[model samples]
Target: MVGVAMGGFCLAPFAGPVLWRLLIEKMSWNWTMWVLLMFARVTVVLIATLAETYKPILLKRRAKKRGLPLPPKLPTGEALKLVVMMTLQRPFAMLLTEPIVRALSVYMALVFAVLFGFFEAIPYVFTSVYGFHPGDTGLTFLGIGVGLLIGAAIFMFLDRTNMSLLCVFQCHRRLNPDCCQQKSERWLSLPIGLFWLAW
Candidate 1:
């Protein structure tokens, strides 16, 4: 699921420029911007309407299980403030306290910085060096997008294989408890990917 989501995220950059170019040619740039803005607004509305709040449902279930009255709802302003504070503070707290989180955060930040640098460089390189038109320059991003999809597929395959191996290891450990120790090998790919990108 995560791999699929990441693929979709990668697809956007590759698809978006081409789509925008078509929209611009058809509708003019001003109208294209307005159309995209309307699309975003509609998406937000649909999500807000369709998305379920699991927290409230879970609270109800807990109260029912205990044979107790439902808890009173928090005041709207207070609830909003609490949510805002937690959302703002928890990430920083984790980044400071958790080594894995901190490391991943720094890695991702560097990766995105490099990705954005490519976004700027690709156009200039393609246009100036290859004498490509604007549309052709945008097409250069397809190579990066294809690389992202390939990486996602590789990681997804590794994750599924790892899960199967983990289940087998667990079964083996049950039979000979002291002989096996569980270890996560999924993260080995991260540095490998980074090295590949550097090369």
Candidate 2:
């Protein structure tokens, strides 16, 4: 459900220039805003129909409707304090204490920044370097979509290969050091390392 809604936000940035071109060129600037607003409204309506996932809120609602006893609960202030403390501490602890998670998190952050930065930089290159119009610039985003598909395919292939090897290797030896060595080697593999650097 989260992925589905997130997809719409990703799609909009890629599709925005095309939509702008169509609406502004054929209709008017005002029409573009109106049409985009309509799409926003539609997205809200569709996503609003999704079932609630927050456990505490959902349990409370169900208990009310069915006249059932609610589960024993923490006091509101204490619960809020615990939630806040855990939320902050969990990530901080993982970042400080877990080498693998920290490394992966940092790598992902860099990649994310590069991806969005490229999207923003596209306009500068297309408009200034290539002398293209603003509308034509969105077409260039097709490259980003294609690159994502290819990268995802490669990542899935790498992940599957790792899992299969892990199963086989673990059957032959203890997992701790062996698994870590294999994972590190794979992470340092030249092609994938270069691929990540290219981002």
Score candidate 2 by lDDT. 0.63
Question: What lDDT does each candidate get?
Answer: 0.63, 0.63
Top candidate on TM-score is 1
Candidate 2 least-lDDT 10 residues: 171-180
Quick one: how many clashes does candidate 2 have? 0
TM-score, candidate number 2 = 0.52
Per-residue accuracy of model 1 over 1-199 as CA lDDT, tens digit each: 5435544565566556545645554456797678679979988997888746699898898899999998889999999999987998887889899986787678668656766766677677768877987656646666765676676576556445554466555633221211122443444544675575445
True-structure Cα RMSD, model 1 = 7.9
Please list the residue runs of candidate 2 whose C-alpha ends up more than 4 Å from where it truly belongs after superposition.
Answer: 1-70, 153-199
lDDT computed for candidate 1: 0.63
TM-scores of the models, in the given order? 0.59, 0.52
